[model samples]
Target: MELLCLLLYVTVNLACIEGYKWTRQNLPVLMDQNTQLLEQSLFREQVENMNVGQFEKLCGIECQTSLPPLNQSEQERILGYETMYDNGTRTHTDVRLRGLNTTESTSYVSSLTRTKRQVFGADGRFVISDLKFITNYPFATAVRLSTGCSGVLVSSKHVLTAAHCIHDGRYYLESVKYLKVGVLHLKSKRGKRRRQRAVSKINQQNMKKRPVFRWIRVKQTRIPQGWIHSKNSTTSLAADYDYALLELKRGVKQKKFMDIGVAPRTFQPARIHFSGYDDDKSLEGTQGGEKVVYRFCSVAKESKDLMYQHCDAQPGAAGAGVYVRLREDGGKGRWRRRVIGVFSGHRWVEVGGGEQRDFNVAVRITPAKYAQICHWIHKDPTQCKTV
Candidate 1:
């Protein structure tokens, strides 16, 4: 009778354990499927892929489409083509596709400056500058990430990178070392040396904020090696949470500090920028020891929980920050910046005996993203600013 009672108790406990596991595993799958179905229905109701002719008719540019209109110059500039020269008296410009080498598209921007005189009034000012041709710089501090890996600085004491950047547990140790931050163009300041010295001497001000750099030391890394389990390894699903935050030995100088910005309640329509050292262009076999920075812009007012951008970048530029520039008070000296997303890298799969391309995804830094990072920084809820 005693043995029979023990057996019954064990059977009941096993059943309960199996039920709990089933619930834990299937709950998220059901929720995600439901969400996907809803999104698809919404997308179908709003819009779908259409051919070129349909787009032109819908946009009311059909009459202007048949031939290269004389107004081609004006149209291109409005489409974010690089504006070359715009003297109040003259106008010149250039427009070209990125990453493509074609002489036809490489028209001089100076010519556009000459054309602007006819387009605008004599007193009209040239708002754009030469440096504007380059893409906007992003990231307060640079980080290294594995392919599709990314991280954030939640704590002043900790710098985050992808968990896969450090450890793969069963297969590999992601082999990441130190991370550097607060770098600016080495040439940006040297060009203005004369005026900078005079201004510093007159005001007795330290202008470290003049696009110089400050470096931080990554003291320790925090990640669980066992997270990449074998059963889940083939699917690569575990990498969805492929994040890690590091504990820095000390904080960078306050002047050079780049605060992680809070996400807006209703996201503003703003362009984003990102920069990173990509390994694809780096010398083979060396582990991202060289620096390679590239910048790209994101789609305006996107809806994904993860902030998505259209910039085409190579593999090495992972872990780059997607940031938006904040302009206020008519763009005075009181300028500030904030980060909105992270370059999560391309999500790819082997198809037809070769790898097929997919969209370049980045980690959206929402309010939760900022809070988690801030918590890691102070480890005290009271210290985090409500923003």
Candidate 2:
């Protein structure tokens, strides 16, 4: 009788575990808009395979048979073409050839002058961040991409990042062999330090800490056509349209994700926050080790597609989510943080007369870009209308 009772208890526990696993696997998946469109097409060719006529037809620029005409707001949101044609009858094929040899004519020269008001120091503006654990709200949303870039979770399965990190204008970067997203695990620093110190004395059976990262493979990636440019295309290299969306093969329901918000056209000077895994700060012998670093600064300048700021950032900081705090709608008492831009790293621009100026730039999310990204997240165009 004793043996039978023990067997029954074990069977019930095993059944419960199996049921939980089944429920977890059946959770709904968030879909990307671009991926959905590509899947619906009859031909499975790469996007580059589409000719100018086909591209226009599919994009609803020519026949308007496939998709409806974009409203003024939507039109404003679309990242314009890389180059302009005199005849206005250009195609992607023409863009490929013509855009290759063109050069920017505008030039302005300026020095990297430091001001009391500017956050201009090499490492002053940025600091190593201690995010406690994966339970933190915004920190939990941060993810490290295998391509040596940082990205943020906008949905359970979608990651938003800079296009250049994955594709450098022409082809995908060599580092992007198999895209992967790494989410940091929750571990106490004091406990970790103790474990490291006792490593020589402790046997394998005594250690209980989990691995640092929970890595998930990426299923698909999407970037705007405007970001693909010829080698000599100056405007494209300005990093105006440097944004991309990644869809992971599995959803990360354990960690929270961030919401998207539009940056106001004009407002009082405000401080914006962003965090990323900066390479310089994450070196093996660095004091902080391989931890996420954070920075905040005031906007220096704003253009139609980009925002200039003085945030101190290194190469690996590209694709960090630029977010700001705002109150909830309808005068709700709760405050929320929403991502308004994507950090595109440092850029050198011609101010005028062949002179160059250096600034850290971010790709601002306009209403249209917000809508497009929302569509990517929900796979429903109607759901993105709120932005």
Candidate 3:
């Protein structure tokens, strides 16, 4: 047992020694706000045969996992690409990466100037709720991560959220082992009928008043290892992989989820919107209130992966889906709402030589990032061809 322990320590160290590094080629293509953004929709042949990125190797060689059979009974994988790897710990096939030829680096430009005052608090600004409409299209898709974080349903069986919600830089969170998603509970007709026939003094209005939810089990989770602050990793680089996907045991049939898309900072509909189960204490503790708070604001500043904004939010609001109102690709210019980023709440960064600054930011969804998320959502390259 002593010898085995020693070998295991050395093995993990070796993996750290080969600690992953980000190459410009493996990172998302950098574009300025003034540039014309080319929307991405990856084909099956392209994604399956294409090479993965540096941070994208969540269960890379170190974890030794693989593609799980879709119909497999037991769940053995949690943070890997279902298409590229298999389930369990084992040595797997390796794909050769294309040579790097760029000298570009990820830049972090700070934005302290404000377009408007940060809107938060319970004074009827942006931090508002509509419990009666929780069963609507987009609001119905909002969910609680059980671990105090918020997430938006991006597909029938997947929830897109911040990686930090489920995993720290080193390992998965203790809460993730029993992760459950809480959906707004639907009203029952039988219960309504009982209330009408109530004779006891304990009436419907006298009953307990609290937000109700229908919890669901999570089957697996996936995140880019880049999000992991490895022993030799840098925080700025790790921030690029903040977004992740959570696969639920079953799909929600009553509600429709929002679709994922690549929306640059300068997208026409400049206003950004999202909703979350904010924990900020409020004075109005009325029936079915405060469970889901909605907010929207203009983009203040943005880097390749991060976008600093004036949107007011609290700790519990992190991981909420950031979206916008825009027209579809070719739907006769029909307006549509799509997710473009994941609200990261507050984050600190190095602005210059030994100077650190903090900002309320979200992870931007670039073309490459969109492609990866698409693969995870549809699983088939064919079905996930377009964003």
User: Could you tally the backbone clashes for each prediction?
Assistant: 21, 7, 5
Best by TM-score: 3
- Model 3 Cα shift for residue 74 (angstroms): 33
- TM-score of candidate 1 versus the correct structure, residues matched by position: 0.43
Candidate 3 lDDT score at position 197: 82
lDDT at residue 68 of model 2 (Cα atoms):
36
Instruction: List model 1 lDDT by residue over 64-101, tens digit each.
Output: 12223213333223212111111111111223112221
TM-score for all models, in order of appearance = 0.43, 0.62, 0.64
Question: What is the descending TM-score order?
Answer: 3, 2, 1
Question: What lDDT score is found at residue 278 in candidate 2?
Answer: 71
Q: Candidate 1 deviates by what RMSD?
A: 26.6
- Worst 10 contiguous positions by lDDT, candidate 2: 18-27
lDDT tens digits, residue span 203-222, model 2: 53454443266789887776
Answer with 1 or 2, whichever has the higher lDDT: 2
